[model samples]
Target: MTKIVLYARVSTADQTIEHQEAQARSAGFMIDEVVADKGESGLTTRLSERPEGRRLFDMLRDSDVLVVRWVDRLGRNYADVCDTIREFMRRGVIVRTVINNMTFDGATKDPMQQAVRDALIAFMAATAQAQAEATKEAQKAGIDHAKAAEDGRYLGRKPSFTTEQFQRVHDMLSQGAGVSMIAKSTSLSRQTIYRIKDNPTESAAALASWGL
Candidate 1:
């Protein structure tokens, strides 16, 4: 029987594999196995370079389903993501995303359908690369700002939640959990939760600024 596999990449210390699994389950994916790589930056590292990621290429068989949170989870590089997805499709593995429920299948014989799928693959891969670049730039700016504020003139307010709490909030939000529920579960105020939800990169920057 064909199996369903979920691949998760946790690049930060506070991130957890369980959170990704939960998100997949909440998205109604009946996952048969999960492969995860901790501290692997999708922007800098190719999927084939990751230990578990390499296992995915080796283990997945034709007709199997491979799921990810987003196309970005495959790789943050445009060419890399495109190549990886195309390779999988060529092998008859159906690639799906939990976030948008997007699917890329190679089984279609219709020329029009093929054109549409290929176009979407290109667009999503390019968008993923662009977003990754933007995030990295944002992080660099945040770090520079934090360093420049060493004089104590503009240290900014200390973050209210710890790194773990921040990660929990992020994970819950991605799972489409209620803000109030997440706030209560994380023991964080609604305002703080909202702030985190509104701009998670800034929230992360705040934590990094404070060396949290």
Candidate 2:
């Protein structure tokens, strides 16, 4: 029997595994198992390196259907994501994304269909990677602009957490703590922890804006 597996990743604490599974379920996938990597940055971590991610790769078998929320959930690197999906397809595993209901299958015998499928995968992987880079650049630009204004006195919006709290959150993140765990330890919301982890400079600027 063909089994269905769901894989989810959250770079920040705010994102939830349930949400990803829900999306897959809504797309009509009868998931048999779920593998999730929480608070792990796709940009920095390869799929093979993640704890749950590694298990997902090992658990997948021929005829198994692997479902994800989007291509980015696989990895933020274009090459890595494409390579991983292709490897799965090569093993006769069908990979699908809930976002666009995109399906990749290696069972196609037609050359033209294979070419089209390969092209789409490349395009989607590249687009996902580009979007991640663009977001990082935009965040950096916003911080730079805020720093330049008011004779470098404008520090952007005020931060919700204190300096000590920010430092603790940073330490926890550096030590590879999970988002939920860090949020609990710091007594801050998951969203705030995400903001701190994703853009440290912006977090600092916000703190400065509040004269913290």
Candidate 3:
């Protein structure tokens, strides 16, 4: 049987696997299983490196269907996202996104059809990556403006984790603890832990903004 699988990645705790699954179901997809990576930033972590992401890759078989909210869920970078999708298509799995009801299949032998599919994939991947970059640049600009106006008193978004908690997370990361372990011990989401580990400066700025 060709199973329908849903893969979801949330960069924060507020996002939920259920939401993605619900979106797929609402779009008339009968999902057999859901693999989710919570608290993991697509910008920093490659799809194959994520714990749940690895599982998703292993679970997908030839003729299976994989559904995601969008291509961004698969990856944040253009090359990585395009490569991952191509890998699946080569394995005979069908990839679809809920956002535009976009479908990508590798069954076509027609040269023109293949060209069209490849073009679409490239465009989507590039667009997804560009959007992520633009959002990050905008955030940095806002922080810079605030700092300039307030003599470094203007903080950015409120800290999602407390200083003490963040310290433990930092320590765990330094000690080479796995993301899941740190998340479990600190009661923090994987995304927050990743943010703290991958970008300490940004994390500190957030704390400073909160006057913590």
Candidate 4:
């Protein structure tokens, strides 16, 4: 039946599922189920690190087809990216890209073609890794620049709700509401929910109490 899986990841908040969905739909692929890794940035953070990404592996079976917008969506480190792809391919999984309709199939009998394919994979993986490193460096420079300008420097994504919003999240967490439910209730991401939960005093002190 040609079961298909779609994976979407955003290293930052500005990027959203809709953006990826539009890209996938334009490629003429109906996404069966999408696995998203939101707000995870480390190049070293493999699919296992992402809550949804690990689940995607569990859902995959032999002969399943996995589609991604690009190879970088899988990973940013060369060895990590290539090894994971090879493992999936070994398991009778087909890895595909929507960008160029690129397909990697290890079943090829042609030695020269196989070698060329491997070489290309290596080059692409290396490029992805380099891009990740470059992003980190550029982010650092921006942070330093902001700090010098005294523009309220803060690393990573800002809490969308501010201190007041975080206090509400903390109160909800204390009341036995699950993070997922709280996020839905408050219109914040689960990561923000946990961040607020983990830092109650700081969050509370940062703003006046709403008297929960």
Candidate 5:
């Protein structure tokens, strides 16, 4: 029997191991086990460097399937992500992702097939790293914006949602909830949800500025 293990790396307060598992389940993956590393930044830490991530290295066996929310959960950058996935494929472990239902396997002996697979892996890995970099930049910008706003001057109109709503939106967003789902669940407008999703820090800062 091929055992399936779900691995999650939770770096933010909004993200949780339960949410990760739920996302995988929703994607039709019957996870047999879950291994998670909390407070681990995928931007800075390699998979083997994480405690539970290292456990996965020793625990996964040939023919076993390893699942993740995305390839980004596997490493810190493009090279690291590529190397980690390749290493797993080399071990005969099938690596799969929930987001795009991506699969990487080393069982193929065909040269053309291998080339296509390798190219796809490279593209995905590069995309993951690019996303991480963009997120990091956004966080930095948010921090700077917050610091600038600390001078006691009101910035703009208060946010439409309360602090609780903001937190809920963030939680749902982290769980891979779509904007429409969140809008329906929270009763917030799609525009408001889009604003929050695009500038989470600014949204939170707006709430704080208004004492909401």
Candidate 6:
């Protein structure tokens, strides 16, 4: 049987291991192996620079299967992701994703179908990359507007908890507090904690995540 390796990533350190694990599990794969690189984005680094990508380069054997949450996880950018997939397919490694169950294998001998698939993969990867970039730009615009509205005296919305209380919550999370403990201490629901873990860029990224 071919080995199946799963890779998950988040671009911010604010995310916790539990958050990503739950996503992968919900995607319906009993992860054989999970490799994650926190606080890094696939768009900013070469494939070889990523821990999971590097491991994939070395560990993949002919006919082995590789999986990720999405196509964006496979590349430095849209083009890079597509090139990597093609190379993996050429190496006889079958690539799959848990989200869409998309697969690429070297078994396709038809050139036309291969060309179409390549085009589609590139388009989809590029779209995802574009969406991420656009999101960043939008967040920048929002922050700028918010700052303007405050006439340089901008303060963030009054969070439910005081800054001191928030600091304690952050500290407790850092100190390995369980969700239940955090809930009891901060009085924030488990769901809020999970949301914080996924969209941890509270300074800017959280603004977009919260529809602000």
Which number leads on lDDT? Answer: 1
The candidate scoring highest on TM-score is 1
For candidate 4, what is the lDDT?
Answer: 0.68
Off by more than 4 A, model 6: 14-17, 149-212
lDDT of 4 by residue, 1-212 (tens): 66788888876544576667677878898888788888775387887677887886788878888888777778887887888788887777888887667888677779999888888788777777775665455345544454454555343333356533453354344335688877875688887777556654433332322211
Count clashing residue pairs per candidate: 0, 0, 3, 0, 0, 0
- By TM-score, how accurate is candidate 2? 0.70
Q: Identify the superior model by lDDT, candidate 1 or candidate 4.
A: 1
lDDT of 4 at 177: 63
| Residue 47 CA displacement from its true place in model 2, Å | 0.7
RMSD of each: 4.0, 9.8, 11.8, 13.4, 4.3, 9.5
lDDT of 6: 0.65
Instruction: Please estimate how well model 5 matches the true structure, expressed as its whole-model Cα lDDT.
Output: 0.81
TM-scores, each model vs. reference:
0.80, 0.70, 0.69, 0.67, 0.80, 0.68
Better of 1 and 2 by lDDT: 1
Predicted candidate 2: what Cα RMSD to the true structure? 9.8
lDDT, each prediction: 0.83, 0.79, 0.79, 0.68, 0.81, 0.65
- Model 2 Cα displacement at 114 (Å)? 0.8
Which of the two candidates, 1 or 4, achieves a greater TM-score against the reference?
A: 1
lDDT of 6 at 2: 75
Following a full C-alpha superposition, what root-mean-square deviation does model 4 have from the true structure?
A: 13.4
Cα miss at 106, model 3 (Å)? 0.8
| Deviating ranges (above 4 Å) for candidate 5 | 155-189, 193-212
71-161, model 6: which lDDT tens digit per residue? 7666538778878888889999988875556787879889999888888788767766775565455457646655556545535564344
